[model samples]
Target: MNKHGLFQGGVAVVQPIDRGMTKMLDEQDDLYTVLLEGKLAGKKVQEHEIVESINETIRPYEDYQAYLDLAKNDAIQFIFSNTTEAGIAFDPQDTLTARPQNSYPGKLTALLYERFKLGKKGFQIIPCELINHNGNTLKEIVLKYAKLWDLGQNFVDWINTDNDFYATLVDRIVPGYPKDRATDLERAWGYHDKLIVKAEPFLIFVIEGNKKLEKLLPLKDAGLNVVVTDDMQPYRNRKVSLLNGPHTTMSPIARLAGIDTVGKVMQDKDFYKFINDEMYQEIIPTVALPKKELVAYAEGVKERFENPYVNHELSSIALNSISKFKARLLPTFKRYVATNHKLPQRITLALASYLKIYGGRADFEPQDTPEVLAAFKTLVQNDDYVTAALADAKLWGEDLTQYTGLVTLVKQDLQSLDQGGARQAVQQINQKGD
Candidate 1:
């Protein structure tokens, strides 16, 4: 049954096979499985690895010098990753077997080296890691690995000269198959395939890489929003600004506002207007993209937020608030600061909610500062206490404490909410911001 259960038993479970998948599957052990719990599982490949998922294949081949060659010969052009920002980390002592370098970047370097050695062709890697500059970051990691391994200047030059990495914006809400409909899905497929993941119908892979990759992949021609451009910055700017930028700023506020999911807050007429007009309309103009593109992009974001397949909770969005503020909110704030010569009011309030959340209240990691923690603890009790918060330039980078007007309003909002109540605070902010 194809989601609607309309076709029912007429549906089939077929692994979409192109030449790329077929080649790797032929060398079965060359792809999947790598001593999970002292045992190998999944279909065997030529490299003595079992055929698992895309990432699993990369795992066994990562550290090997011949990694790039295998990918070239197999016609495998892309590497899609969904690892966390932390996942791309590196450890100094990571060896061939035990640590396997223990990082997405290190692991990827090993794979690239394998492909490069085999046939000396570039792999068009499109990492879906949701990290800033996914391709460039991956490329940087590969270079780092080469240096660490003492693989010589020639390898580094080869990497610099012959690699094509695509920094991609992948926007499919792949919630890893419907657990709720386990029985029906299993019965319909007529077999058990744990790897059968579920993703929203809407899939977008926007790559800012080599222009030649578009002609090779042609995912856009396959009815996907797979755009290829040298400047992924504008697209990245649009999404980060319209979708993620608004979402991050509003999430803690929404949680404080008593709104749970993005869908719920969006349903409120006035709240939606505030977000659209204030957040998107007002802030989006500061970006270089045309207004129409911004609107269309934001409209798509609303649907992605409403995707029933994924439960992207507000609390989840609230993780690592400090770093997120730096990556997501800080950029927009800086732009606004550059223009207005002061902290943006809505953004300031958003930061205030974050400060309120950091009072030993949420599950985020606090930046290891006793003063910072102490201020958060104190400020949680007194929402209007912008003096201490603004004074801590280490956090805010400047004295926003003097922005008493904004602080007073945020304090009023913060004071009204019950202690540790993200929902109520969020609701109030949404209403006021509206």
Candidate 2:
């Protein structure tokens, strides 16, 4: 919205009291400003005085009554927030009358109650959190808080009928406050703007809604890459499985193979082939969307992985590999097995590599639960490590031993990895895949 001229109507920045990052916002806070340097060269890019650029009133939480008065007078029409992924949580401790609540949903509930009391109009609420069904999740949390506060059925009905909660998928790489180039930028811009944000050219905001939102937003009219769809699930799945799944599954395998970054991993022919197979053969086959669309998304993911500009460290991606595996690759593994009556070779090999990575030989340390680390620490020394780890239902959420031939296959892969290295292990799996 800031990139476009839509925010010329002005935007308000309300600090949720418990966000903990309020000091960053409040420290020498002047005019709640941000300088958006547009990447596009055509009509979308325009020069504006720094003052006209994101000049919103920074409302402190102590000034809740002031915002309440604004609500009462119907001063605000739209509420847009990017409070991070963990922002939309329910806090039972928050109350309607206790100044303001701690959680974002709680604060929203209090403000909406104020509006409900004044019989004011409903406002469109859009949350830019990365969680699935974010808008619906926020609404659920708000309702939970509303009921928890015993705010009566009228306010509840008003919440259900009046406001609009939009689940949004926001994609942009905004590395805030480019500290490295700040001196050069300040000299070039002829201003010491502390709020200048550096972002990539790519931007996408997909809203899950019907035609009403389409007519309301009309962001596409401004040449923005905004998509309004009835179902955001397909987009969400495509991104998660194709983009995130490759990162999660490949991190341990590449790192254990002495590869440091994703770009370097892409440089290796065998490792690159394994990654391609993981996406095209294992992951893409499980997606319910159109095959062409999935293939294109996968190709884009590969390009991103191979991006020379991005130094995506495998060690960083390997953080919490256990949970990442559960979220990213496990579903596809299960689905492939159920459909083909055989394990996904690439994912199974990746899992074996994960076990080795967590076995504490990699240059980077394993960051996972104490139990998981402890299990791997002891199991790595044992001959039956594969069987033990697979059978431990706590680790995988299921007794993986029930799957026929899975244990032997994983054990063989682990043996090959121990005897040779990551390259040899990948060669063994690639040969099996062939």
Q: Against the true structure, what is each candidate's TM-score?
A: 0.65, 0.69
lDDT of each residue in 80-186, candidate 1, tens digit only: 56554444445566543433445667766766666566646665666766667877877887787788877678778777777777787865543443446656655
Deviating ranges (above 4 Å) for candidate 1:
1-77, 89-98, 113-122, 175-196, 256-259, 268-274, 303-312, 315-324, 355-359, 363-420, 427-434
lDDT of 2: 0.73
Among the numbered candidates, top lDDT falls to 2
The 10 consecutive residues of candidate 2 with the worst lDDT sum are 39-48
When summed lDDT is taken over every stretch of 10 residues in candidate 1, the lowest stretch is 10-19
Residue 52 CA displacement from its true place in model 1, Å: 11
Native-vs-model 1 lDDT? 0.58
Residue 429, candidate 2: alpha-carbon lDDT: 73
RMSD of each: 10.8, 6.1
